[model samples]
Target: MSASMDIRTKSLSKPVNVAQYLFTRLYQIGIRSVHGLPGDYNLVALDYLPECNLKWVGSVNELNASYAADGYARVKGISALITTFGVGELSAINGIAGAYSEMVPVVHIVGCPSTISQRNGMLLHHTLGNGDFNVFADMSASVSCAVAKLNDPAEVAAQIDHTLRECYIKSRPVYIMLPSDVVEDQVEGARLDTEIDLSIVENEPEREDYVVDLILKTLHSSKKAVVLADACAIRHRAVPELTAFLDKTNLPVFVTPMGKSAVDETKENYGGVYAGDASHPDVKALVEGADVVLAVGGLKSDFNTAGFSYKTSQLNTIDLHSDHCVVRYSEYPGVKMGGVLRKVTERLDMSKLSVQKIAHVGPQAVAEKLEGADQIIDQKWFWPRVSDFLKENDIVVTETGTANFGIWDTKFPKGVTGLNQVLWGSIGWAVGACQGAALGAKDAGSDRRTILFEGDGSFQLTAQEVSTMMRHDLNIILFVLCNDGYTIERFIHGEEAEYNDVVEWKYKELVTVFGGSEQRTKKYRVNNKGELDALLNDQDFNDRKGMRFVEVVMDRMDAPNSLRLTAEASAKNNARRE
Candidate 1:
C-alpha cells in the first residue's frame, strides 16, 4: 500500500476536509443554516455546506449579513456569518460591535488568502496596499469574545471548538479566520466525538450560598420589593430563573427598555416598561418607590436608563449579574447570576416574602385613555393598536428610530421575542435582522410570525435584505412607517435640518422590483386608521403564507412620546454646559 493509504487505514476515524469539519461542528451545535454572501475566498468552502445539510443564506451585503446573524443568534442561541478578508469583514464590524455591546452570540468567519500568499506578503485586493493579512484579525479581536486564526491543520478542530465555546458561554460574537487553502486541508474527523463545552460558569459554592442568604434576609425584611429584569437576563439565558422568581414572589415586575419581553407581560404581577424619566407615570412611581430592588441582568445604557435618569438607589439594590453579585454595598465576584438566581429561588421562603398586590398599569390599558380616533394615523394611537395586533410567539424586530421607542408603549403577548440594537443604536439593522430572525423562527420549528416596523429612513439603508428574505420564501410582514425623514434625529438636534431627510422611494413597489411574484409577495398602502384597520382585520391578509409589506403614512413632526422625552434629554446632554 502507498505510505498515505497505509497511514489512513490505521487512523481512528476517516479524514475530513476543513470545511466539512467546520460545518459538522456547526451542525452538531444546532445550526441548520449558514448566513453570508459569497466571495472568491469563501466560494469553494460554500460548496461543502450541503454536504452537512446546512442551508446557505446569501445576504445582499456583508453588513446586512452580520446584522442578520445577530438576530438569528438571539433567537436560535448561536449563529454564524462568513465574509471575505478585509473589505467584507470591515463592513460587518459595526454589526459585530453591536452584538458585543448587547451580548448576542454570533460566529463571524472571515475567509482569507492561502498560507503561501500570506507568507509571501502578496498584496491582496481587499488589502490596504500594506501587504498585511493580520490587520483585520487584530481589529476583529476587540469586538469578539474570542478569535481563532485557523492556519494549522493539526490544531484547526480544537481552535474552532474553543472559539465556538467562547461564543456560546460568553454569549458574544467570535471571529474565525479561515484561509482559502485551508478550506480543503485534511483534519482528523475523530475530534468531533467530543462536543464543545457550553456549560455556564459555576460560582464558588460557599460564596454563592452567602450571597443567596444575604438576598433572602434583605427580601424577607423589606416592606416593599420590586424585581427589575434587563437585557442580560435573556442574553445569558436565565429567563427561566427570572420568571420563576417573579412567579414565586408575585412582586411587581418591570423591565428596562433593552430588556423588553424578558418576562411574561401577560402575567398579573407585571407592571410596565421602566426607563427612568421616560417611564410611564404609573410605572415610574411604582419602581422608584420600592424599598428593596432586585435587579437581574441590568444594562443601564444612556437611552435605556433615560440619559442616566434612574432614581433607584444602589444602596438598596441587589444587582444579580452574569459573573458577579452585588448586595447593597457588598460585591461577590465570580458568582454568576444563573447559579445565584437558581439558588435564591430554591431557598426562597414564600411566607417571609412581602408579596406585592397587582394593579393594572401596563400597555393594554392605554387604549381607553386615547381620546381621538381621527382618520390620520398618529404615533400615540398607532403603537397601542400594534400591541393588539401582535400574536403570541411572534418575532418582532424594530428599528433604532421611532419604532424602538414606539414599541415601549406596546405590550407583547406571551412568548414574543423582541430583536433590536438599542445600545449600539445602529441604523438599518431591523431589515437585515428581520430576515435572520424569521429564518431563526423557522429553524426553531414553530409557527411563529416575524414582523418588522422600521422608519422609511432606516429601512432605506439596507432594503436589499428584504430580497434575501424573498429568496428564502420566509414568511415576514414589514411595516414601513413613512414620516418623511429620520424622526429620532429630528427630535435630537435637527427638526428641520436637510441632513436628516432622505429621498423617499416608492416602498410598495420594492417587492416587485426585488423580483417578488404576485403569488408570493403582497403590498399595501394605508394612509389612515380606517384603511389600516380594514387590512389588519382581513383574515386572508393575516394568514398569508409569504412576504407582506405595508407602507403606513404618518405626520412628519409626530414622534413617539418616549422618543421625544429621550431625545430632549439627549439633546440637552450634547450641548456645552454652563
Candidate 2:
C-alpha cells in the first residue's frame, strides 16, 4: 500500500454523475422507495434511482403511491415519492394534502419539461394547453414549500439539502421539481463529501414561563382538574413527558379518539378513550364538571369534542394544540400547552403528588371492562380472540369503517399500541401502516410482531400491497375483518340494502391470486369463538412461515356500538346546526 495513495485518495480520483450523486444522497437521508407511476418526463430519475439502491414502486395511480409513501414516512421516519411533470403531480395532490393536514414529512419529487420547452409554449402531456408553470408551482403552496428548477446541476446538492432540512424543521411536506434536461446533465464541478445530515432545528414553544405559571396556579385553585390529550401530544412524542406531568399533578386523564394511544391504556387513572360514550361515565362527569379544563394537543373538530360541548363561556378552558399554538377561554389569561407543560415539568414540587396510585386503578378499570366483554368474548370468534392474543409489544393497525368500530374495545397490553386514528380518517391506511410498522420493527432488530386488523371494504382498496409484502416476505400478520358488507357506512348513514354491501370474496385466496406462494400464506376462517380460540392458542400462527390471513366472520346485524353512536350523534348534530 502506497502511503500517499490511500483509499480516500483513490475514491476521490474517480468521477461520478451529479444526478447519480444526488440520488445517493437521498438514500443516505432515508428515502427508501421512489414511489410513483412511471411517466416520460420522470423516466430519467426512474432509470438513475436503481443504481442508487432505490426501488421504484409501481402504483396503479400516483395518488395511491403518494399515500403509501406518506403512511410509510409517518411510521418509518422518512420516505419520498416521485411523479411526472403535471399529470402525475396533479393526481398525487390528495395524498399530499392528507400528509400536510397530519403534519407528516414526505418529499414530493416531480419531473418537469425542460426550461426552453417550458418557455416555448409547447403542449405538455398533462398540462391544460397553457405553458404557465405558475399553476403547477402555486398548487403546492397550501400543502408544501415547492421549488421548480431550471437545469442548474450545481444547485442540485444545495437544493436537496435545503428542502429536507426545511421540511424536517417545520414537520411539513416539501416539493422539488426536476426538469428533464437537468437530470440528464453531468456536473463538471468538484464533488462535495456525501454525509448524512440528520440534525433537526428545534423550535422551543413560545412564551414558556407564563404558560406553566398559569397552569400551576389553575391547578392549585381547581378541586377537580383534567388533562384532555389529543394527537398533537403524540406527534411531539410528548407521551412520556405528559405522563410524567400527569403523575406529578394526580389529575385525571381523558384522551380524545385520536389520542387513544397517548398514554399506556393499561395504566390506572387513564379514562379509556373519551368522546361521547367512549368517555366512561366517571371520566365524562370529571370532564363535563371540571372547573379548569386543560385540553392538551386537542382537535377542535366536532367529532373530538362531542359537538363542541367544551365551547363554553363559563368554564375556564386552557387549550394547548399540536401546532405549537395556544388559546384560552377564561376570566384570566392562560399560556400555550407546550411551553407551560415543559416549564412546569422541569421544576415542580414532586414530593406530594402520588399519581402512580391512579396507574393501578386506571388499567384495572379498562381490564375489568375487557374481561366483562370476555364473558361474551369467544376464542372461536375472530375479533375477541385476536384481541386477546395481542401482547404488550405487538403493534396493531385498524382500518376505517366497521373494523375501526370492532376494535374500539380491543385491549392493548399496557405498552402495546399502533396508529389508526390519523385525522383525515382515510381508509386503506391501516394496511399500508402495517407494512411500515413491520419495516420499523425489523429495522429496530426486534421480534416485536406487527399486525393489522383490516376492514373488508378498505382491504380491497390496497389489496395490491399484498404483492409488495409477499415479495419482501415481511414478518407481518394480517387479520381481515370479514363482515361481507361496508358495515361501518351502513351504521353511519349509507343504504345497507344496495351500495353498502360488497360481493363476498374468498379473501384468503387473494394471497395466491396476488402471486404469493402456497408457503407464503396460511388461511383460516373463524365463524364462532371456538375457532378463534384454537387460532389464538396456536403458536404456529406467530411463525414467519408465511403471511397469515385469518378471516373472522362478524354479524352485520351486531355492528360496532361506538361507531353506530358516533354516526348518529354526528348526524343529529349536523341537523341541529342546520
Candidate 3:
C-alpha cells in the first residue's frame, strides 16, 4: 500500500469585481428587482443582476419605472432603479424628484459609457458634454446625494457603500453612476459586504420646554383638546404612542383625509375624519369648535389643511412629526415634536382621567349612517358590506374619489391600508399597489388578504397591473366603484359637468379579458343596496382561490366627504363677499 500525502496551498484572494460585488450587496439589502431599460453602456451590470437573484423590471418609460420603483420602495422600505447614461437618467429625474420630495429612499443607478469611449466621443446613447458630466451632479443637490464614476476600482467598494448608507440616513433619493468598463473589468480586490442597513434614524429632536408647557397647560385648561393628525404623522407610524397619550388624557382625536386611519375610526374618542367631507354634522362641528388643536405629522398641502388655512397667525397650532421638529403656528421655529411628545406623559398627570373612555366604536353606527343616506346612492354604501367581508388582517388599497371616501369610513379591525398621496395622486394606485402589496405580503410569509377598491377613473390609469396579477395567479379582490367619472376632480375644481365624466365599462369583464377563466374567477355587479347585501352574503368569493371583481354602480354625483366641505366653504366665501 502506498501512503498518500495531502498537500495544502494557500488560496489567493483576488480583488472582487465591482459589478458582481455591488449587485450582490444590493440583493443582500433586499433589492429583488432592478427597474430599468437596458442600454449598451450599462449591459455589463445588467448581465450580472440575475446571478445575485435580482430581476430586471422593464418599464414603459424611465419616468414610469422610477415612479413604480418609488411606489415599490414606499411599500417595501428601499427602492432602486437603473438606467443607461444621460437620456435615460434625465428622463427619470421627475420621478426621482418626486421621491425626494416625499422622503422616499430610492437609489438611482445610471450606467455611463466607459472612460475610453467617453474620451474618444463614440456617440454614446446619452452622452452630453465631454468635459463635464455635471448634469446629474447638479441635480443631486436637490436630492440627497449623487456620485459619478467608481473612478478607481479600489474606491468602488467604499463609495457604493457610503452612497447607499447616506441615502437611507437622509430618507431621500441618491444618484450613483457606474462606468461600463469598471463593471466589465475583472475585479482583483473587491469584497461583497454584509447587508446594508437601510433603516431610517428614529431619533427624536430636542424638546421645547416652553412649547410642551403651553401644550400641556392648554390641554388641562380645555374640556376638549382635539389632536388632528395629518398625513405625515400617520405615515410615520406615530399612532400607538399618540393614541396612548390621547387615551391617557381622555382627549378626542380627529384626522384629515390623509390621516383617515390614524387611529381606529370606530373608537369613542375618535371624532371621525375631520377635513369636511361628508362626515356627520356633529363631527364637523366638533372640529370647528375645538378649543386647542394639536396638529401632528402635518403638511400644509392644499387638500388636507383647507387649502392652506391655519397660517402662522391664523391659528394657535402645535405641529409634531417624525422629523422630530415642531413648528407652532408656522411662526415658531418649533421644538422637536416627536421628542417632546415622548416625554409628555412623564411630566403631566393623567391618572385623573378615565381609561374606559377609549372604547372601540362599533361598525354598526357607520352602517346605520350608510343605510340612512338618501341623496347619493353610490358605492360609498357598499363599503360597510365590503368591510364586513374582509378579515382583520386584510390589506386594503383605495383608488381616488368616492371609492377612497367610502373606504375612509371603513374601520379595519386590524391590518394595513394605503393610498398614493403624491406623484399625480393618480387613480390607478389601488390596482398597482394591489400588485405590489400582494407581492410584498407573499414575500413576508403572511396570508393576509389584499383588497383593491378602485374608482372608475383611477382604475383605468394602470389597469394593466391586473394583468400582472392574473399572470401570477395572485388571490386578490377588486371592488370597482363604477360611478364613471373623475369624481374627485369634479369636487375639487367644482366642475360637475364636461370632462369629468368617463365612458363606462363592464368592470367585471376585465377578468375574462385578462385570461381568468370561469373556473378560476367569479364576477358580480350590484346596482342597488339589496344586491350589495346579497353579494356580501355569498361565501363563494370569500376564500383566496384565484381572483374576483365586484362592480358596485354608484351615482356619479355621490360627492365625497371632502367635496362636501369644499362646497360649503365655497358657498360661505361667496356669501361673505356678497
Highest lDDT model number: 1
- Backbone clash pairs for candidate 1 read none
Per-prediction tally of clashes: 0, 18, 15
Q: Residue 245 in candidate 3 has what lDDT?
A: 75
> Which digits, one per residue and each the tens of the lDDT, describe model 1 over residues 1-578?
34674465356376888999999999888888889888889889999999989999988899999999998998888999989989899999999998999999999988899888899999778887777899999999999999998988778888998999999999999999999998987788888888777887688899999999999999999988999999999999999999888877789999988899999988888898899999988889988999998999999988898888999998889999898889999999899999888888889899898887858585663343434444678888888888878888889999998899989889898999988888999999889899999998889886688999999999899999989989988889999999999999999988999999989899989999999989988999998887876787788888987899999999989988889889998998998588
Per-model TM-score on C-alpha atoms: 0.97, 0.84, 0.79
lDDT of 2 by residue, 349-421 (tens): 5553333223321222222223333233322233444556787777777777655554545656766755664
Off-target runs (Cα >4 Å) in candidate 1 are 1-12, 365-374
lDDT of prediction 1: 0.89
Candidate 1 vs candidate 2: which has greater TM-score? Answer: 1
Q: What's the CA RMSD of model 1 in angstroms?
A: 2.1
Q: Say which candidate scores most in TM-score.
A: 1
Greater-TM-score candidate between 2 and 3? 2
Worst 10 residues of 3 by lDDT: 1-10
